[model samples]
Target: MTRTRWKFARIIGIIAASILLYLLLGVKTYLYKASVFLPNAHPNEVWEYVADFSNMKYLNPTIEDFEIIEENGNYNHWQYTVQYKEHLSHWPYLPNYAKARFSIKPDESKSKFFIKSFHTTCLINDFLCLNSESEFSFTRGYSSHGVHCDEEIAYECPAIFARFCEREVKYQRDAIMLNLKRRFQ
Candidate 1:
């Protein structure tokens, strides 16, 4: 082939390779943090609901079952069922059962509670999901009459398609927080 034609082909090949690599191996994991604040809400009263991880059902309607394997003061090892109604959402969560160790720490003022999760299993058998954790805090917002809840999710998965969990997580979190706001205030 001519020199110019050969160079043009090489450049095209490189571009194609880069695109393929990005599609196959890129964005396998994601970290997201979200928060909601409600005015005219009681902080301690809100903490009662937020401190217990089992209370997730109050926020996430998709949770069909929640079982506590072990429990102590402000700490629990639990498993819960997640229902993915639509086909698009069900594929990634093959097993649909999740297990995690969650804990809560409340400040002396009782205005803030920190909830942390560790050793979380996204799928029943730990299939496609590699690692995941949700860190959440419920506190008093700018005013004593207001309540604030913050959540951070650090998730990792080997499959590129598994990253879809990020959007789902954000949506569910927002839904639950809004539910809490309406319920309390």
Candidate 2:
């Protein structure tokens, strides 16, 4: 083999090895599923709390502002601008801005509330790659009602993406419950 050809082979091998190492060790683990029980508030009240888009600033800690640019009754389509700071193990904390669309629905008789949020941010960190759009839906119910929450994140790293989805959903749910508790108290 020629010297140049051997060097090219060595370089390709090194590149492949580096990619494998990144996949194995450079990926981050994000929180995927989480839930909290709010004892006193009913689903209807929770729905009302979430329905008011402008109230997001009070509910979400990381949200700098939530404006309802447009809406139509139960189905409200609006833009959400959020600012967040994250700390990695070896890197300095980084701040990020994200924008998304939100939809909310309420079933008064059944005492159930549903929320859907779609975000445009695809990548959270260097190792966490979000290849697909982000979406989350949460259902809150009263005593006899059914409560559920689901989140979907399309990414090359499902494990890490799942964790991030879980944390995001949990934060929104908890925020609604907290607002309801405060309002009634």
Candidate 3:
């Protein structure tokens, strides 16, 4: 009985120490990038859809919902819920929403647009992410008949959560790009 109790106490102590160490871990940064070409999409129309923050629900599968906190001439401030796309057994600590300020600004030539989302919240995803920023550029096809889109994301999280965050981001991006293609072309 004494030996069994000692073993149990040691196990509990180890688990506690592991949890404490994880909580103390510093943030790990990640960069994600993806590009897509829409042959049947016109640059103007694509810009209209991609630049609108209100259309996030249609474009991103991970966005369960979004609320516009403020809107200016060329900028939008919104809060969005990021829920698990797949069935998660149980995760109560994950943040359900994040706040961000985004801008859709046209270039001097008016043929390209810079779209960005700057996370205003702590980017707290229950230790999954500490900070995040997204940028997208939509340019008129050089000589083709469509639009060229480039997307990049820079985020920081604990190293243990990096893989999961990266994978989730990629999955969401793939879905978003596919939806954009379907809607425009």
Candidate 4:
């Protein structure tokens, strides 16, 4: 086949795959919840570390850029764009130029921290997901050994993108937790 023909064939294949993926995904939203525990870390210390959104790019290098839209002491509303160089853009976890927002606030007693994130836009050279919301709670507790810290997150994403988005989101969360655990350890 000619080079032009090969390019055309590849484009067609991509379109067909996208259509098939959309069909399989349907129109719906999915919620994903996860929990992770950090050892040797106080709740307040962990909360302070996670709440600092600016430093997240270092924690998760996939973040291309991070900005603080609003801030109030430990409580902050922030936005960041992610850039991933995965083998396939359709992998969901590696959306090119994905944008998201995150913020959290702790309760009066400073025992529990509440977090909310809106993954509003995902672009693969084009607009993709409309919206995905994730709410999280971080708590500092005690165990027989010492400080016991736990964090839970509830995530909601469009079904069409969930296959890809969920995996990427989980990877990001897991990476963050692993780093945090290592720090406290």
Candidate 5:
């Protein structure tokens, strides 16, 4: 093949690879849902169980420790310290310490509770790109006999961090729902 033709072919190959990488890493989305039966408790009673931050330790398996830092009007802000072990492409192993603030609102009429949290994962020494801010919103509904929970989480980070955020949210949500069911039953 001619040298000029070879150069053109190489350029096209590079462009195609770049496009594929962007699609694989650039756009990501995640959602998780779970529901369990309460059997005997009223919806209002169940909402109260999930709304109190102090009960988080009993209801959520992912939270190592949490405390309320401020309260203003209907918004109560709290800080949570979370520990999770994760693996990265460039790192052999990584452990994360994350701090987050949660804003919660309790709706008695609907027997629903809503919480929004903003947090940043701890930084790895060599991988600064993994440190990113994430936002998560959770909605939980209680009926006379059961409860339903749904959560949405979004993170703005490089492709790697985005993928991690998606996985972590699902994991945490599932853990919390499982714990809640165990305690209530």
Candidate 6:
């Protein structure tokens, strides 16, 4: 009985230490980027849909819902919810909703527009919750081929777990952009 109890205590201690280490070492912020071009669309045409935060519902599949809480000029404060995957649907991992403030600027030539999210309440996901920023630039007049789009994400997470999920994040971004292209072209 004494030996069995000692083994159990040691196991528990190890688990506790592992958890502590993870909490300390797994926290970080990362910047990610992606870009794509729309074959037959122009930046002006795309801006109408993207400049409005609520339109993300049509562009992004993961965006279950989007509401414009407030708006002032080219700035918007919005509340949105992402579709929760099965594994992330439990306990604190499940988020009620996300909030973000975004802005849009038309270029000097009016041939392009730049949209950026200055702040967001949710980072990548609930498990890796932190502050995040996103930037998107839509440019046209490059020989009339199409509009070129570039996007960048700066995410600050308390856990590095999201690093492993980069592929999913990339796919999600691309899918949204693809949807935008389809909508415009």
Best by TM-score: 3
**Model 2: residues >4 Å from true position, as ranges?**
1-5, 21-31, 75-93, 122-185
TM-score, cand. 6 vs. native: 0.69
Q: Where does candidate 1 have its weakest 10-residue lDDT segment?
A: 79-88
TM-score of each: 0.69, 0.55, 0.72, 0.63, 0.59, 0.69
lDDT of 5 at 22: 84
lDDT of 2 by residue, 1-185 (tens): 99999999999999999887766555343434334344555555555565555666665554544444455553333334333332222222443344455566554455455565554443344333332243444355445543443344432334424455555545654665455456545
Provide the lowest-lDDT 10-residue window in model 5.
129-138
Candidate topping lDDT: 3
Please give, for residues 92-160, the per-residue lDDT of candidate 4 as tens digits. 364454455666666737577666666655456655545667666667655523234444444445566
- Inter-residue clash pairs, candidate 4: 92-164, 93-168
**Which RMSD does model 2 reach against the true structure?**
6.0
Q: Candidate 4, 137: how far from true, in Å?
A: 1.8
Q: Give the clash total for candidate 2.
A: 5
Q: Itemize residue pairs with steric clashes in candidate 5.
A: 38-145
Q: Over the stretch 1-185, how does candidate 1's per-residue lDDT look in tens digits?
A: 99999999999999999998877755465788888887877666676676555577667766666666666653222223232221113344444556567666677466677767764444545454455778887778775668788888887654565556766666777777888877877
Candidate 4 wrong stretches, greater than 4 Å: 1-25, 72-95, 142-162
* Model 5 CA RMSD to the hidden true structure, in angstroms: 5.6
Candidate 6 root-mean-square deviation in Å: 6.1
Per-candidate Cα RMSD to the true structure, in Å, reads 5.8, 6.0, 6.4, 8.4, 5.6, 6.1
Per-residue lDDT of model 6, residues 49-149, tens digit only: 78765677676656565566666663223323333222221233543346676677777465777777755444345443456688888888469668888
Q: Which is better, 3 or 6, measured by TM-score?
A: 3
